[model samples]
Target: MNMITMGIEEPWFKDPGVADMFGGKADVETIEGTNIVIRIDDEILDLVELTVARFHDDGEWVWDTPDAYGWTRNINGAKEAAMKHGWSEALLRLREVVPSEVVSVLDNIARMAAAAVRN
Candidate 1:
């Protein structure tokens, strides 16, 4: 489903207090542009880009840094590591506001990004 539809269907967005959580506005368009940065040790990774790339070619991901080479050696392992280490204080706070279905949420966002590119 599209983001607007997802927002409408999701009970969280329907709550009046949801707007206050997002600085008095719960715009789906604004949330659509949200970026999630994942850090693995000293390396920073784009969560959306990684999710999209992972599904694009049988789950293979590449990174530029020499240190990244080791991280990408086992793709699933790297993803698990990222999920474990990437939760920032802001994200932890966001988790309290949003549901815990992070994997599903990231997959949907990645799909939307890919569809946007195609159209």
Candidate 2:
């Protein structure tokens, strides 16, 4: 099914209060422009939480380093560690806390990334 179809029916998608929890606060045009919501059934909120943590950890690594190589290596290492250290658990916990509908809205991000790759 299409991203909208999958997400619209989810519990998180309907609630306005929890919209921002899954990165749903962004404008419709931006969200639609990226088409990030490809897999509506996917755990988008969980992924988003993981992404935030990824950036936070990677940023810290970069801040700690001095050279360009440090930027790349540390960022890469942080990502590797994040994924290795239980990305699944992070996402699962995010899902447990955030609403399912918000998660659906967040899944659209995958579509956006896919579109970027194809281009």
Candidate 3:
């Protein structure tokens, strides 16, 4: 399958609030700009496992988290996705932790999302 692999945009992009897969408290406010609240329980974990079980469903299996420019084949589509999913806030928080390229991507997407709402 010639699937176009997608790299993670930032370390905190998936769910920054999730400290770990084990029972960990969410990082509600430490994210600074973003107010994203994540509460992962057994059910959420179960669902996540069903999708991918690379580490044998072990939460401790850390991933080689990537730092890339909001990776996506489509830039405008990424912006629209961020807007549709209320991820602009998360992107704001992610911008602070990622590299300059990542920051620029997130900032651009966020600005576009904001402008889209006004139109």
Whose TM-score is greatest here?
A: 2
Per-residue lDDT, model 1, residue 26, is 34
Q: For model 1, what is the alpha-carbon lDDT of residue 63?
A: 21
Which residue pairs collide, candidate 3? none
Candidate with maximal lDDT: 1
Candidate 2, position 2, lDDT: 26
Candidate 1, TM-score vs. the true structure? 0.21
**TM-score of each predicted structure versus truth:** 0.21, 0.23, 0.19
Ranking by lDDT: 1, 2, 3
Question: What lDDT is reached at residue 29 by model 3?
Answer: 28
Please write out the lDDT profile of model 1 over residues 1-119, one tens digit for every residue: 21211111111112232233334223322221112444333444234211101222333432212112223544455444443333343255445534444566788999999999999
Flag the better candidate by lDDT, 1 or 2: 1
Say which prediction, candidate 1 or candidate 2, comes out ahead on TM-score.
2
The total of clashing pairs for model 1 equals: 0
In the range 46-91, model 2's lDDT, one tens digit per residue, is 2321121112332333111011112224434544443333334444
Model 3 bad stretches (over 4 Å): 1-98
How high is the CA lDDT of each candidate model?
Answer: 0.34, 0.33, 0.31
